[model samples]
Target chain A: MMKVLTANRLTDGIAVWLGANGRWLERIDHALIARHREAVDALEQAGQSAFHDNLIVDVAVIDVDEVDGEIYPIRLRERIRAKGPTFRTDLGKQAEFQQASAA
Target chain B: MYRYDEFDHDFVGQRVAQYRDQVERRLSGEITEDAFKPLRLMNGVYLQLHAYMLRVAIPYGTLNSTQMRRLARIARDYDKGYGHFTTRQNIQFNWPKLSDTPAILEELAEVEMHAIQTSGNCIRNVSADHFSGAAADEVADPRPYAEILRQWSSNHPEYSFLPRKFKIAVTGAERDRAAIQVHDIGLHLKRNEAGELGFAVYVGGGQGRTPMIARKIRDFLPEADLLSYTTAIMRVYNLNGRRDNKYKARIKILVHETGEAEFARQVEAEWDKLKASELKLPDADLRAIAAYFAPPELQDRAEGWAGLAARKKDDEGFASWVRQNVTPHKHPDYGVVTISLKPIGGVPGDATDVQMEAIADLAERYSHDEIRVSHEQNLVLPHVALADLEKVYHALLEQDLATANAGLITDIIACPGLDYCALANARSIPVAQEISNRFASAQRQQEIGALKIKISGCINACGHHHVGHIGLLGVEKKGAELYQITLGGSGDENTSIGQIVGRGFEPEKVTDAVETIVDTYLGLRESAEETFIDAYRRVGPEPFKEALYGKTSRAA
Candidate 1:
């Protein structure tokens, strides 16, 4: 229900699914996306490319809805994305996991 | 005069380094514009409409000859051979490049200065009475306490990330030269019944869109608890202050919403936890800070009244300058000289390189190498000997810095409105110029008597228009510039927000409106002693309203 789509002509582009009813919003070169290399890369891989001397990015996404045009799974996914990951995912946590694996 | 200790030095060095890293990252494409926005803002670098502006703090409006010289150097090397001294006792380099800020910070740090906490949502460079040490009416020097607050709030982890930018002002004198009531936190230094130092703390005063005079939170807070108590207030504001709307994010709004009594109770609860902390400043530390600001050695000399009288009798120009620019100093043989940056029709606060050097020379030679940037956007030599007044006045006249309109109607405070500010809705400088030209007569100004006319291009109130006796606010209506007039605002000990007189006026009609208001005041005034504000208060705005709108109009 939730789709992360990237534009072919933009870099650091993100297409967020807002609600159902095929309402897809794209934010390009946003501060948060610009800060996260992985997020930017994911968008780039999904077809977003550098534009306007690499300063701007263009991206798009698609969303399907139920009979009433109400977004359900897409809404949930967008909410999750907006809030970010709940658990710790930094290098310190990774190192702890690595130590446990070695033990 | 608070010298940067090892800790202070290290912190500034680290701050510069951190900002350098952020700059490097932004330049190298490691971080995008979005990520670097906050980072740049935190370093006092703003991408203004035309160019990047670097606001360097002049803490408590106090500066030594060396610091001022360094500022001159910065103006010469980095910026266009001039700088704009702001209402907040800070200087802004109007044309700094984004890439050159780190080097600028490095240079500033060399002079025991940094742009830290200047632009960020933090305890900004705490402003104080310009005549802190030299004012005739001052009970005690306020700079020592200001310096203490500066240190306490510098990189103070918890309060640094508040909902909005915060400003604090201190004054030891009875006359509120610092405009304390319009600041986020206003500290009035007072001696208690037991002869111990204490603060009459006021909270939630600010001047942006909603200009409110700070309400007194604590009638008497012990001097030792200044830091801990302030920390508690800031913590409470940071936690409970609204972040949803940027306009309502100021502590004033929070205080308004929660009610002062409840807010004070909450602050008290927070202070209970912080009272037992290491934030309580030691007597030795206070003494050490106070030692740096100890009064300069005074020479026993005659009051030079005869020399001043002789000059006044001989030269009309010298007499005019003395009448307007000279203020009473605490020392019998000394007087405070305000070297006007507002030269006739020039920008209100802009000083060229030559002017800066000239003032610096005057400060070192005549005054005691102490220069103060007043909240009214003028420079002051706090301790000019009475004998040297004529010489200093002549020198100032030569440099075109001597306007001799310190508190007159010509001494207008206007923000860099639509011309430079990206947020301005209308032009402030031109309107200020129009008003200044209208009141160009010395006789009329003397009659007006110490009136403040502040103008802001927008509701942001960067010009402190809310506290002006005549407040001009520029608003956009139907895509045209319209000016609103407010009367009877006072920024002194008895602070009050000005009330809007009537409907907005066209840009061209604003001067006429101001004249009408002044005319009304003059006609209604009981005597020469009763100022525009006094007459307005006594007679009410009805006369002024009648003068502006006429009797036939029914619209209030």
Candidate 2:
């Protein structure tokens, strides 16, 4: 299973996925996929360092599965967090993601 | 409405200044999240799934037009143009930023409102019967007593940090509209044989992972001893409540561990000492506070009866709204108008800023400037004159607020579950919306009269699912949403924790299951008057189980 490190930004508290470029990206699709032990460990380290630096809070490495070239969270909670509420399509990061795709 | 005095103004101003400094420090990286979390929580700032959610105290569900307008302003200016009213009669902005919270608090304070003691492990905002002063059946207005509790509990040095968060509710009516039995301390204000006001105090009742009905500790405590008696109960709970397990930390567990009888004894022993002390409320002060809640002088608007009759005879929509939303008031000329936030398939308890502003205008025009937030997630204009109800209904219609569903199947009480809450296991709003949409027909809803379908995403029971006529608790099973249905739960004078029907249903099947339950009730009910709760009580869960799961199946 691939893992992605995620946390909410300190100032705005928006959920962000740790991107491959070592930047916290708001879009989960741009998240860094750590499939190996060393990469997962590095992701954890980045999360820990980010926490101490007060860049993010509630850091977690959640399990994800890629199918048909699409990444999706294993847990419903993290999925909701990554996207937005299942009911309200126009409100979360998903909305922005949709907007970016449409554009 | 009780106006904030100078002391209140200074107190709120100082707290805002203090919180502003704390927010600044945290923003500056001087304060860490670990240390700042508690401080932020004390001001009702919660970090939810999407963003920081702020729960502002409504102070016993009572609000004047100015306050309501101010809340609308916050909704428009700070939040996402909407606010969700919770079961505690508090309004929660689902999309508040951490940095904006201080300013929000400042704005709230401008209207004599604050988020203090709203979230911490302290006495939370004291809620009262939404229809307290206007209800025809009420013994007296309960907001005064609730305000007294609010004053006593807010930032009390001794009880600030307890084993867990404590909730207290007051109901002046015998009907138990405040859900007092499900609170940490439930005070039922009543009159004794001598016609003197007092309270029937129930201690250690709460709903969460472990739902328990409160036990009556004192049959009658004099109104004067409200503070003294409550102080003693707090003292006992503070000393004895379990702090070892976060799950078992509520005073309900303490009252359960120490037998209710023994708990009563300890509280009585503690009260004996504080009864004659300075905690005893003076008559003059009590009267003074009560005077602030004095009912507006209403001359006999006897012409309203005929006017309302003619209007109702003409307009079917107006008649249905008045029949469903408006309840009898203390005065014959007026009625308590409940504005159903639950529109068909709409989110329960949510009002957009525009809708809120419109409601405020209606309150200012018709309800003597008073509005109320009901724990059942509806807004109430408690003093709407009968003559002006047509106007109120017409105005509410303009804002999509005139839903003629009060105590009906569509009037659901749902918490912000996985949709927004960080602690939720599944989404509650969609489920509520689905169930509401399924039972959306006004005729069908009236047929299934007085049915409350309360939904919570998790076992935290923020939606009061444990007390619903048909309760749906959403749980995550194998990474999917599974909703368990509970039967026969009620939060009225005769409160009962609902019984789980059987194995849970999937998200798609949950509404069908509710329909099955409602159908079963309709099939077996003796008469239309026998409510869903009453029918479920009489029939037991056997038939409903047979209907939901096959008769061959067993309970989960």
Candidate 3:
């Protein structure tokens, strides 16, 4: 079981996940997977520190699964946040990611 | 259509700057999210499931072509190339950056639009009938009073922090197209026995966890006492409305608990104290506000009706669109054309930037450069000439907006639901989409005849599911999503809360169940003239319940 720290960027209200490099990344694919209690605590502390620096808001631990070496949020809400509005696939950040990946 | 005066401009400008600074402080860690939440909400910025959603008030649902175009431009530049017109007759941008909100507000201000009082516990946007000025049956244009209320309620010092949000609606016509009966304060313009213009006031009506129809408090309130009476009502609610439990905080609960008589007494006492105050609009000021909403000078273009009839005969789609979407205007030559935002399988109320621009262009060219956002999640070109119906229909068809299902079955009113809203338990748009697709045929929809299917993702009732002819309320039972069906509810002059029928159905089975109910109604109807609502009222919900759940299932 893997968990990752996720929050909205305070400046832009964009969903960002805590990366393996300890920086907030917009794409969840780069999220740091916390497998141990110590790792989770460290990620939580890092998220708190980011809050103090006003880097992110509404930080929470989100469940994720690494399938075929690609990280995906397990919960529906987190997945929606990672992508965009579910109703319109062509409009949200998910669409931008798709466009970028295609490019 | 009301232009912002110097004072109005300065007020909005100052608020934008103040919000900009607040955002700055929040970003710089000077303010915590807990502390900044209310402040951001006060400025109509909400952190939804994904991003910050900005709801800009379309005061009384009126907009000019320039303002409409600017909204499209903002949608293209700042948002996701589209916007959702909310049920409160306001527009919501689902994806607005918190850092960019100040700039968005600044841009909105340029168009004399703002997100002030759009959210928060304060008095939200004052909405009126979309066909306010042009409605043939209207006693007076309600937008003037709605505008006056907007000016009075915007950033009011006293009602800033209420127990819960308050919604006010005004309707000038007897038809009650504004759904005034379900608002916190529903004002219906009326003429007294002496033939003097006044208002019949209804208080405490709201649709949420507990849907309650407003009780008529005043038979005829003098036009001069409009603001003073409103101020009194708000003051009474502000003081007496529950603050302990958020669910019971709405004025409807206050009116329910205290009883209508006691509430009316308290309001009257408050009115007695405040009726002669500075809140009372003078004759001169009233005239000034009313002037902005005077009907447009319509030309005598009734002569071209023969041509329009010929075109309608040639095109079956156009004829159907004309029959369903076109509304009779106050002027004989003019018609109110409703552009359905609910295209087949499309998200309700979602309009793209290009579609918006095209709509604006059509408004400018055909409908006196004015547009209206109906509370039913549709746009109205309120003054299109009857002769121009063919051209407008073709133009709308090109944009894939000519759904021709205005008040028919497919024009659904749905909240952002779980997909976009943080508070939703189940997704509403998908369900709406599924149902819309189920009833995709124009011929079938026409046969079904005027069925409103309102879907809400939660008990908040933002989708107005409480008052739909066939209301679908989504609830989370254990882990699975279940939809509760309510039958025969209406949000009209004869407003009634729909009764729940039998048990909740699984999400996949909900649309099929709705189809079953519609089929039952069709079978039981007296004639083709007997609409869904009328038939439902005449025969009650027994047969429908039997069709939904088995014959053994007891109706609630």
Candidate 4:
């Protein structure tokens, strides 16, 4: 299973959820809601909602799950997204495994 | 001390402009790494493992106080706070960014220095004896001719993209301080029967995996045809040298395959066509270059041994420094002092920013504002008065540059090995440090006498291990660092290729092996005057082999 979390930009913060076997499946949304201007004004006049103005320009979604934490590929991707790629750590285990299989 | 002429200055300026454009293109994403690789390399910018490295040529190891100060400024501003002087008489900045290289080159051009031909398959920086003009045993100074070659080869349109990088060295001295025999073309200056200066030229000498002594191509090449003849030889190699295998691309392989006589004949045939052409150097051009290297004015001073003895008696440290660092000069009242870069456990050839400034200051104060970087990875004050030796020694000591181990055992030549170099197989400095620590005692080193131990991390032989009296080659064996030892090599007048004694030794066993070889020499030597090379030549490697492997013979 795999899931994606979105933020403002690539350099902005990111969070992901992983399922068992070190994978993600469920997506969670935490975004601003947009409403018609008249409806918002009416709500403000009637005092039905606390929000009176402002329309949503952006939204973000996150995925969360438990993971087995043993699969290297899933762990590596999570690690890279969390931090950054290792500059001098040679190649990943997946590449080494592929090479071994090819050999 | 060859200053740039109008033509040289213009050529360097054009090169700097070209490099600036290339750097701009690289930064603007117009050129990819693959496309810009050769372009940047042509300008002596290398994308090394961690960062970009720029190799600046110090032609024939000669520099004035102004140039030294400029190098110090470059180190302080552009690079990391230090510069590593390489074994090829070049200085490498290990931490220069890609974008700052052009500005660095522009600054270098201000001081009449550039990094052209320091890399790539062009004629690299021409090297010569460090004590070129001042040595008493010299036939003539080789720098003027070196300068002539430098002019002829700098970005020569036809031969720029040769089979591989080419190197040339010239020496006029009796002792081969320039390691001429290991260069692509080694020119030994000699005078003919008519007292005309000429060159005894050797071709195809190099020190990689297939280490070979250069063979004599011409006994006496007249000074007039120097450039034209050199061009002919290079052209012949450019056309005939190997291109298929990078390992076999050097002219040494070409000489090996074609036979020396045939190669010499081919060069002669090529020269016959081009000898009287525009490529030949004019006498006026030669004289112009020679004028720049004219000796500085000397003052007649007391020549007696009084000054030296007085210094020796007054300061023991100064006495030790003089005993090791001071070398006889052509002038009676002066001497050459080698500031050893190989201080006990320090990185060889590394001078910190402060150290560079201090050396520059010392040169200006005491050395007639002249300094030289020897190919052996040490700084030289070419003209130090005998009376001021103590003063200079104390000043050097303040900077931790005063190590009295000029030609001693601990004064080892080591490349920036695995710690820094991307090409290295194993670390060279630790091994060198181990050796230094094992033989740190001054008394022991003095007893050992003049011994040169050169170590190279890989087969490229940048550290010139093949020419050392004791050569150590670092190799990786089963994921462990191993060292191979060779005995009996000499880079001097009677050049000889060292012979490998036996199989490789583990790192832990190498120091003991070296000690055993030294002990074997001490036991077999005829007298204390017989150096390590002489003893090795006299007795051969059998005794040393016996001492190391202990009667167990390994199949070759």
Worst 10 residues of 3 chain B by lDDT: B547-556
- Per residue, candidate 1 scores C-alpha lDDT tens digits across B75-134 of 898776888899999999876767788999999898888888888788899999998889
Ranking by DockQ: 2, 3, 4, 1
B1-556 per-residue lDDT for model 4 (tens digits): 7777798899999988988888677566566556767888888877443346789999989888788888888899986578988888889987687778888899999999999899999999999998888887888889999998888788788878899999999999768898898889999987999998889999999999899899999999988899889989998999999999999999999999999999999999999999989978789988888898888786765653697897698888788889999988888888889999988877778888888888888899888888998988999999888887888888999999999999888999988765556577766777888898899888899899999999998888888889889999988776567899999887888888888889988878888988999999989999999999988988899999998888776443
In TM-score terms, candidate 2 sits at: 0.98
Which tens-of-lDDT digit does each residue in A31-96 have in candidate 2?
899999999999999999999999999999999988566678888888888778777788887787
Model 4 misses residue B377 by how many Å?
A: 0.3
User: Between which residue pairs do clashes occur in model 2?
Assistant: none
Q: What are the per-residue Cα lDDT tens digits for candidate 2 across B44-109?
A: 999999888999999999998888888899999987789999999999998888889999999999
Candidate number of the best TM-score: 2
In order, what are the TM-scores of chain A for the candidates? 0.21, 0.92, 0.89, 0.20
DockQ of 2: 0.82
| Minimal lDDT window, size 10, model 2 chain B | B547-556
Report the alpha-carbon TM-score of model 3 versus the true structure: 0.96
- For candidate 1, what is the DockQ? 0.02
Residue-level lDDT of model 4, residues A1-103, one tens digit each, is 3333222111111222222232221211211111345533432332211111111101122222334322222222233223221321232222223321100
Candidate 4 - CAPRI tier? Answer: incorrect
- lDDT, candidate 4, residue B206? 93
In Å, residue B55's CA in model 3 sits off its true spot by: 0.6
Q: What is the DockQ of candidate 3?
A: 0.57
- The two-chain DockQ for each candidate, comma-separated, is 0.02, 0.82, 0.57, 0.03
lDDT of 2 at B416: 95
**What is the CAPRI rating of model 3's predicted complex?**
medium
- Deviation from native of the Cα of residue A55 in model 3, angstroms: 1.0
